[model samples]
Structure formats: structure tokens, C-alpha cells
Target chain A: MKRKIEFATIVEAVKKCCIEGTKVLPQDVYLKLEEAEKNETNSLAKDFLRQCILNADIARNEAMPICQDTGFAVYFIEIGQDVEIIGGTLTEAINEGTRQGYKEGYLRKSIVTDPLFERKNTRDNTPAVIHYDLIAGDKLKITFAPKGGGSENMSGVKMLKPSDGRAGVVDFVVNTVVNASGNPCPPTIVGVGIGGTFEKCAFLAKKALLRKVGEKNPNPLYAELEEEILNKINQSQVGPQGLGGDTTALAVHIEYYPCHIASMPLAVNLNCHAARHYEVEL
Target chain B: METKIIKLTTPLTADKVQSLKAGDRVAISGVIYTGRDAAHKRLVTALDENRELPCNLQDAIIYFVGPCPAKPNTPIGSAGPTTSGRMDAYSPRLIRDCQLRGMIGKGNRSQAVVDAMTQYGCVYFAATGGAGALIAKSIKKAEIIAYEDLGAEAIYRLEVEDFPAVVAIDSSGKSLYK
Candidate 1:
């Protein structure tokens, strides 16, 4: 029997998630910040990390957004095979929730109606980017991640010859962070996607960011690479806010997929220290 | 490295700007105007038409910010600096044509902007980029002064007290960007 779910139920849950997502820092992120603060050596960088931790607390307690640029509302949803929607399309429900959440939460509407020429504000920050997948259970899971342009704009993709190998991927990732410097708000979390087609690689890179901070990749080799990349980034001395210190990145998360034998595609996505996100199970 | 701690009032004089150096910590008090991309274009267009600016620019500090709306009782919501590179094209003109003396934002400025700062006796300050909630505490008042249609991007006159920032570029053309 198909379990019927009302569209309104999804909207309310999504709305709550959107509001809470921007207002509160996830536990994993908070823990990472605290750990980074304790391990940070430079006095100034340590102080900046402390400020960020305190800022997160104030935002959470006040029910205010962690950052002014409330960001593009991106959702990852998993729908159970046994569930059937009753009232409206899933996309519309998510968008309605985004509109109310951004407006009610008093978050900034950063979306422009057009990319070029006559760029105009969308007002309520609608048309959320929603990605969906089907699963076996009878429940629904939704994760809301508000991605700020400061870090989003810094993301990059590079296509290399298959022969370039692991060294090539490392160089590309490090160079992207180096070029970004303090612009993306340093002590960033790096998400890397290797293999796949051009667009798939980019998607994988962003999806990698949804992983819990400091959580190792399931593959031992990938987990080792994550640690190596993290070490290399911290050694760059970009520090907190790129002022030159020991902690340039908190963690490096990588996801890979097999690609055509001829091409090796790599993508890098960065999330700032705030890294606000929340999840809901319905 | 010894960093200077400065307490500066608004409508800063040339001497005040010259006294600042790269890496100094400043707590600024007094009135400042907020303008991002849209408001900046409008200001420059007005100048091209030989029209008066909405706010006086003499020794003025323009904060490159677009803040969220205020909640009940609060003067402003989470407010932080946007990337300074976005305003580079208009900043040199604002400095030369409007006597703008200071700017507050994050990241590096264009070479033209750095040169303009030295030529016009101005300084650039960088606020903590993502600490919007903490920064809002210093802002006591916020009112839209022009381009209200721009919504969050409208020009705002803000009354700030001890607003914290770091001097990223001094009047001598030296910058912290490199």
C-alpha cells in the first residue's frame, strides 16, 4: 500500500528546516570549529576562530541567520518508494517553503532574476535548487544547505588528461584554494569531486560538502587523500580570513565516480566557516 | 607585528587617513553610508549628470555592505562587508569626484583603486567577513537614504559606534592584499 503524504506536510517541514538551517550551525561544524580553535597556533587566527564560534552561538540563540547572505536554498531530498504525494508537486512545495522561510527569518534575498544585462532582485528568494532521489523505505528525508556566493563563486572545475593521475588532482585543488585566498572566508571546508562527466563531477563536489565535518571518507585511500590535502592546505598558511596562519581548511572531503577512460575531471567546492545546514526526516 | 588601534570619527580628514597604516585595528564611530553595486552605479550616474550626491562625500567612509532588514527593537540585522572587488570600478571615480576618504569591505582592491586611494588620500578597511551578527551590534541606526527600490541594495545612512575593522590599505599606496 502506498503511504499518502500531504503536500502541506512537506512544506511545513521544509519551512522549519530552512529557517533552522540558516539560524543554527550544525553540531559537526560547531565541533570542528572548536577543535580548530584549540589546535590553532597563531594568536590572531585563534582569536578570529573564537569570534566565529561566539558569532555562531549568538546567531543560534537569537534565532538569526549565521551570515547576512542567506544564500541560495539548495535541497537534497530522498523520497521513499512506498510514498505518494497528494496535494501538489514536490518542487512547488519546496519553493513555497523557501519563500516563507527566507522572508519570515529576515534573511537577505541574494538571488538575481537574470544573470546578465538587466539583473533584478527576485524579492522572496524563490525557485530553490532541489535534487531528488528515490529510495526503498516509506519515509522522506530532506536536507537544506544554504550556499553563500562568497564560497560558491570560489568553486572551480578542471579537466585533465587521464594520465595526469593523483598528482594532477592535488595540484588543481590546492591552486584553486590558493587563488581564492581570503575571498571565500578562510579556514574553509573543501569538497572535491574526481572522475565522472563534467557536470556530474561538479555535482559530486557540492554533494561531498553535505558530509559531516571531520568525518572520513569511507574508502581508506580517499580518506588518506583527504588528510593529505587538508595538511597541504593548512601548510599554505592562508590562516583565518587569509591572514596567514596554520589552519586554512578544516577538512577535505572527496567523492569519486568512474569516468570515460580518456578524461579525468576534477571539481572543488568550498564552504566557509559558518557552513550552515540542517536536515529533517518525515 | 605591532598593530595600531585607532579610534576615528566620520568625515575623516586627510591627516587622519594618513595616520593609518596597513594592519592597524580601527574602531570607527559616527555616520557612514552603505552602498553596494546598484547604489554605486546610481551615485556615479548622478555625478556624471552634474547632480548633487544623496549624501555628502567629503571625508566620507562608504561601507560596501547590503544588510538584512531589522527585526523588532534591533537597529539592524546581521551586517557584514561584501567583497571589495565588486566596487572597484566605481570606487576610483567616487574618490576623485566625490572626495570619498575611506571604504570598508573585504578582500583585495584593484590596482586602479589602490592608486586612487593614494592620489586622493583615502584608506581601505576590512571587516570580519562572515561575522555579520557580531558586527551588527556596533550599528545603532540604519535608514535608507536613496534608491529605496533597490531593496537591500539601497543606500543607507548608518550610525555606528566603535565599529571594528582592520586597515587593509593605507594612503601611501601600501596594501595588505599581497
Candidate 2:
């Protein structure tokens, strides 16, 4: 018999995740900021980093958002093949949770109803961007990532010839951070996606950001590449808020996918130090 | 090597603008108007049509911000600066046409914006980007001034005390964007 789960349970879980994601900066991210604070040379940048830590502490204790830009709600859902959701569609449940969470928690409603024409506010911040995958499990897992516009707007993708090679990828990643500078709220966490189709490449880059800050990839080659990119980005001297210092980026997380031999696609997604993400299981 | 600390009050004048230099840390107080992307479009449109703006632009400083709604008994929720580049297209016009003397936000401005700052005598200050909750401590008052239909993007006049920021660009075209 298939394991049955109530739709209301998913809604409540998602609602809590939304509020928690906005209010709490993950412990790993907090520790990385502490490490960045210790290594920073410029007095001004160090002071700025300290303020970021204090801000997070206040948000956590007060149950408030770390930044005013509460961001667009993005969800990654994993459902078990043996699980059945009763009473409502998964998308509807997730949207309802987002509406209640954002409204009741006092989060900013940053989403617009239309992109090109109407450009009207969605008011309740509904219609969250949802990604779903099926897995062999009996429970439903949901991850909420509130992506802020300042950083999301700075993200970009490039199509490179296979000949561009590793050097090309490094240069592209470094240049993206340099070009973005303080716009994405450095010291930023950079997520790079290599290979795959155009859209998949972008998606991979965003998914990479959900990884814990400072957590290395399981693949040794990719883990080494992550460290190398992080070093090069910090060398850019963009520093904290692009004010010029040694700690331009906290970490660089990369996710790779197989692609055609003829084409190489790369995408860079940046997240501010807030880097808020929370997960729940139902 | 040292960051100079300065205090600035709104309704800024040219002399005050001239005194500010790149790399200085400023604590701004008094009343400053808030407007982001959409409100900027409307304000610039008003300028193009030669219509009166709801707030006086003479020697005024505008903060590029859209704050979260205030909670009970609180003046405002987490309030911080938005990216300055989004306002680049409209900033130069506001400076040249309306005497906009100061801007508060993060990131680098466009060349046209830098040139306008140089020609019109203006300065750019960057607040700590992710420190919204801390920044809110300095904001004592906030009330929507216009465009209420825009929700979070509405224009508001904020009364801040010792609101911290850094001078990213000075009146002399000096910039710390690198």
C-alpha cells in the first residue's frame, strides 16, 4: 500500500520553512562569515562583516528577515514514488503556504504578476517557482530558498566552445564576480554550473547555491575546482560590498552535468551573505 | 588608509556635497526621500513633462530602497538599500533636471551617472548591503509620501539618525568601485 500524506501537512511544513529560511542564516554560513571576519585585512571591511553577523543574530532572535528584500520564493521538492498527496495539488499547497507565511511573518512581497507588460505586484507573493523530482522514499521533502533580486539579477550564463577548456571556465567565473562587484552584496557565495543544455545549466547553478557554504563537492576534481575558483574570485579585490579587501567571496560551489561534446555551457549564480535556506520533511 | 567619519543631514547643499570624498564613512540623519525603480520612472517622467513632483528635489538626497512592511509598534521592518545600478538610467536626469545631490545605495554607477555626478556636484554613498535589521535601528520614522499603489515600492520620507554609509563616489569624480 502507498504511504498517504495529507496536503495540509505539506502546507504547514512549507509555511514554517519559509519563515525560518528568511529569519535564520544557516550555521555553516554564519561560521564562514566568522572565518572571513578573521582573515580580512582592511579595517573597514572587517567592521562591515561584523555588522553582517550582528544583523543575522538579531534576525534570528527577533524572528525577522535579515534583509528587506525577502526575495522570490523558490522551492525544490522531492516526492517518494510510494507517497500519495491527498485533497490538493502540490503546487496549490505550496503557493498557499507561501502566501500565509509571507503575509503573517511580515516578509516583503517582491514578486510581480507580469514580467514585460503589466508589472503589477502579486500582493500575496504567490505562484512560487517550484522544482520537483521523484525519489525512492516514503516521505516528502521540501527545500525553500528565498532568492533575492539584487543577487539573482547579477547571475549570467555563457556558451563557450569546448576548446575554451578549464582556463576559460575560471576566467568566466572570475569576471562574472568582478563585473557584479558590490551589486550582489559581496562577500558573496558563487555557484557555477558547467555542461548541460542552456536552461539546465542555469538551473544547476541555482541548485548549487542550496549547498551549505564551505561544503565541498563529493567529486574530488570538482572540489578542487571549487577551491581554485574561490581563491581567484577573492583575488579580484572586490572585497566586502566591493569596497576593496581580501575576502571578495566566501565560497564557490559548482555542479556539473554531461553535455554534447560540441558545446560547453556555463552559468554563474551569486547569493548574498544572507544565503537563507531551510528544509522540511512530511 | 583611514576611513573618515562624517555626519550629513538631508536637504543637502553643494558645499556639503563638495566636502564629501570617496572612502569616507558617513552617518546621515534628518529627512531623506526613498524611491526605487518604478517610482524613479514616474519621477523622471514628471520631470520630462515639466510637472511638479510631490516632494521638492532641490538639493535633495534620495535613497534607493524599498523596505518591508512595518510590524506592530515598529516604525518599519528590515529596511536597507537596493542595487544602485537599476536606477542608473534615471539618476543622471534627476541630477541634471532636478538638482539631485546625493544617492544612497550599493554597487557602482554607470559612466553617465558618474559624469552627471561630476558635472552636477553630487555624491554616492553605500550602506552595508545585507545589514537591514541593524540599519532599521537608525530609522526612527517612515511614512509613504506618494505612489502607495506600488506597495513596497512606494515613496516614503524617512527620519534617520546616524544612518551609516560609505562614500563610494565623490563630487570630484573619484570612485572606489574597483
lDDT of each: 0.88, 0.92
Best by lDDT: 2
lDDT by residue for model 1 over B6-104, one digit each (tens)? 899987888999999987889999999999988999999999999998999989999988898788899988988887888999999999987899999
- For model 2, report DockQ: 0.87
True contacts kept of 1: 0.54
The TM-scores of all predictions, comma-separated, are: 0.97, 0.98
Runs of candidate 1 exceeding 4 Å displacement: B1-4
User: How many steric overlaps does candidate 1 have?
Assistant: 0
What's the true lDDT of residue B37 in model 1?
A: 80
Candidate 2 per-residue C-alpha lDDT over B86-143 given as tens digits, one digit per residue, 9 for 90 to 100: 9999999999988999999999999999999999999999999988898988999999
Q: lDDT tens string, model 1, A1-282?
A: 998889999889988987888888888989998999999988767877887888898888887788888889999999999988889988888998899888888888888888897778889887798889999988899999999888898999999998888889888999898778878887899999999999989999999999999889999999999998888888888887777678889989999999998999999999998898889988
Model 1's TM-score against the true structure: 0.97
Question: Poorest 10 consecutive residues of model 2 chain B by lDDT?
Answer: B1-10
Docking model 2 quality class: high
